[model samples]
Target: MVRPRLTIYVCQESQHGRDPQHEHEDGDSSTGTFFVYHAVYLEELTAAELTEKLAQLFRVPAQQIQQIYKQGPTGIHVLVSDEMIQNFQDESCFVLDTMKAESNDSYHIILK
Candidate 1:
């Protein structure tokens, strides 16, 4: 299935606080529901490249995959579609930062 880019919406939000250009469609924000994340790029791979890769492997729209970068080598927070989750048996398998990412750097992957 070819994932069209038109359906993909990439907007920058201030992780916190209020901004007019946050692009988030939440006008009724009487409550808080946003959480910041820590990220890394040990492999130092671009999120755009990884996103396309995962989209193809997971058989979903590439734009659907979301990644958040932090001040780390390879500890980025990734959020992908449920459909993508079904196809996580690929060569890339990412683990949590709490765990040691030693010699296993080769297996490091992105999960948003």
Candidate 2:
């Protein structure tokens, strides 16, 4: 089956941990509408492990998160909704907390 492409436009204020959804009227998922959270970042964690962690943290089934980057010791992005993103940012939950990790290997979650 065909699916919609979700290329996130990382908001500049993503690191601030604030309310940041700017959906457009067209109801587009990736463009001028909808604050769908796609890529999530977690510091000091490998993409593979981070993916697993996200599934557990969100109580999701499995294989929900996917590794987008091949290199660089950065955070992992967990696929989620705009609402979930808000929660993550507000609570600095599993994904947002990664940005504060002391290890450089850690990752910071981002929407893709």
Candidate 3:
């Protein structure tokens, strides 16, 4: 199967609440356009666990993932764009008060 490329563009202009699909029409080409793929929603991931998971996901060494995690949110931003947070929220639900909190989120990401 073929997958559609995930293209991301960051514009210098102040714009918000715009749909990703209509980004081109909303801004000038001179801003900045980036090409990124594999943005994962972060949930039920502690810094330690996230490091291991990221290493596996990116097929890189665990030390590299640790370095990124140590850099804090900025490093994570380098690995994944913040847009995935909104994408996750829009596409998922977290029963925080439930007994099986992680199960649902994990299931949503892995299976459903």
Predicted model with the maximum TM-score: 3
Best-fitting candidate, scored by lDDT: 1
Writing each residue's lDDT as its tens digit, candidate 2 over 1-112 gives 5432221222221322332364443244343333323353444334454456555555654443332222123644544543343333321311122232354434434433
- Whole-model lDDT, model 3: 0.34
Taking every candidate in turn, the Cα RMSD to the unseen true structure, in Å, is 12.8, 14.3, 14.8
User: What is the overall TM-score of model 3 with all chains considered together?
Assistant: 0.30
Q: Per-residue lDDT tens digits of candidate 1, residues 53-95?
A: 5456446566454342222356444444444443434343243
Each candidate's lDDT (Cα)?
Answer: 0.38, 0.37, 0.34
lDDT of 2: 0.37
Model 1, which residues run further than 4 Å from truth? 1-44, 68-112
**Cα lDDT of model 3 by residue, 1-112, tens digit:** 5442322121123435545665665354454442222333345434444345545654655654322311233322222233433233333322111112243322111111
TM-score of each: 0.26, 0.24, 0.30
Task: Please give the TM-score that candidate 1 achieves against the real structure.
Answer: 0.26
- Count of clashing pairs, candidate 3: 0
Question: Which 10 consecutive positions of candidate 2 have the poorest summed lDDT?
Answer: 4-13
